[model samples]
Target: MQPNQFNVDAANKLKIVSLVSVGKHPQSGRMRRADQDSRAVELGLKLTGDNHSGESLVVLHAGDPGEPNLRSYAGMGLKSVRVLQLDPAADAILPLGQHLQQCGADIVLTGVRAESGESSGMVPYQLAEKLGWPIVPRVADIVSVKGGVAEVLQALPRGQRRSVMVKLPFIASVDSAAPEARQSAFGPASRALMDIEVVSASVDDVRQAWEEAAARKRPKRLKVVKAKTAAERFKAATAKSQGDGGKVMKNESAAEQAQAIFDLLKEEGVLR
Candidate 1:
């Protein structure tokens, strides 16, 4: 099949890649739910194909071969899919980039954060840096693709949205606002097999030393805002609030009560 013919539902198509990690279950130490891994497979499907008609799709699952999560990922979708095995000890970010570099995918889609591992939400940035490609983080939708540029919708805080266009070979960290991934259609997915594509990289190219990344000085840590105990939480809830005591007195006449309340809150640091 021709390269661009991928959109025609031919046997070959571009690949969406996701990194999977084995996460220990919070309750059962023996078994884990591959939620992040499965979500990755889910995002891959939405990014590469429309619900009905579109290109054939492939999910490139990157992780260690022996991780049981690999089987779960394999069951996620079907057709032209691959489970890429990396060194069991390899740090994921760099090795993932090396694998994608060899995979020749048109686009790489990953979740904003993994359920396991460091959970730093820095993998897409690190992978883009290593691969020398652009990254669009927290993307809510793939709006359109034409002429090697894909336009995307990005989710911002306070329910705001922004539009961006990135060239092919770009990385996108899918936000939860994107369309829900479909359930694995068993007939097709069960028919699929694990086609492993092994990518070996030069040892010298991988970045190590967490200290190097820490030196960059990113966002400051937000306060935890958590109560240490249930009693503490109850005490905090019952404690007298900012207006000197339980009740916030309106300094103005009765006609202006609502406005006065708002103004009092503004003065007391309760409202922005």
Candidate 2:
């Protein structure tokens, strides 16, 4: 479907549930960076508006309990947020879907993947399977949602794009290709003291053991190559191997240079 055909103003009105991973920021390295969580919230807010029908934005977190990031999301124009906490040991997909189902979320949105732990890049697909909802990865926009269906724009390789229509309660994994997430203002971030009511887990046995697991083993040897700069990285990329012999070339015409370059690339298996 063409993206221009759908009505974005209408889609922005539907209720949305945003799933996110609360983690340390790559730049700040804080324990739980609100900036990252707020970024995800910003996208959710933009797609589905500051309010979700009458239900607030649902920020589902896995593993971490501190949840310091919720404040930033609240600061960044989100009217309300629901924190669905789950057992850190349980399967992330199952628990996340269970919580979202209880919230009655019409559309579930999440980042492509988390920045910490497994970062599997499989949460959206897995959650969709568990919830029997359509999964759309690399989502760029929500154009419309009506009659229990939603129209969305998805990013494709090489700058290509496509629009699709999926039923409500579908799952979409937001890509970096979507609009850049905004920074949180300092005043709002500091003053926002949102309430966080931790929900108790209902599961008794949450552990899953690998069948062929063995005692943690360490490798006998280690090899490390560090490059401090871009030039060093390029040098490493073009470095000669132990079995490779250096070659001598004479200055030549443009065509000869081109042929020599092709020959070198072919020898290095860079050209086929």
Candidate 3:
């Protein structure tokens, strides 16, 4: 089914909370806005506007409110954002859970992963476990929300998509396939306000000592598939390697070129 084909209840108003985070610049190693988290905020705005159900949108953050990164989201039309102030050394899970509970939001949206330190890409699942709510990852778009359930379009590998239905009070991690975020407006950003909530939290005790090192690229490994039959084994052993080392047809007649093109397409399985 298409992404837009879904039934929605216009009367069921929803409260959606989007979590935003600061990302790091790949080349300059500087702090910058996170595209994934920003996209989630953009999707939240699209869902809450009059075109949809007119749900209320709430922006949340768990970091230094004074950070310049937070203001970037404000420029995207968020009038205010709730900031949960916690000890920098503490794990953000506990404090974030407390604030989300206080807000009484029906749906929580976040990026697939954070861009900063220890980017484990586990926040959404961890938060779901803490709140006892179902978590949907890689959501491309929210199809509809009605009858205490939400239907969403999930992104998959190979340019494919799947539809999902989850009950209310669920957490969703937006994928990059979702709509691109709008540019942050300077006027709204300058006028935006931060609502700070100080929460007491302690760092989790680590059983093992941790170490840090410079990141490096790892060599790509060839996939090894098991073959049970002799024919399958032979086919696997002779599988074509991925590279451009084929013949090139230069200086040929139109009919010959057309025949060669047809042969190449058939070889590639692009034509019968």
Q: List the candidate numbers ranked by TM-score, top first.
A: 3, 2, 1
In candidate 2 the C-alpha lDDT for residue 161 amounts to 78
The worst-scoring run of ten residues by lDDT in candidate 1 lies at 2-11
Kindly state the number of residue pairs that clash in model 2: 0
Specify the highest-lDDT model's number: 3
lDDT of 3 by residue, 20-67 (tens): 888887777788778899999888877776342223678888877788
> Candidate 1: deviation at residue 17, Å?
3.0
Screening candidate 2 with a backbone cut-off below 3 angstroms (N, C-alpha, C), the clashing residue pairs are: none
Candidate 1 CA-lDDT value: 0.61
TM-score per prediction, in order, is: 0.59, 0.63, 0.74
Q: Which runs in model 3 stand beyond 4 Å of their true positions?
A: 1-12, 50-55, 207-209, 218-272
Query: lDDT score, residue 21, model 2?
Result: 72
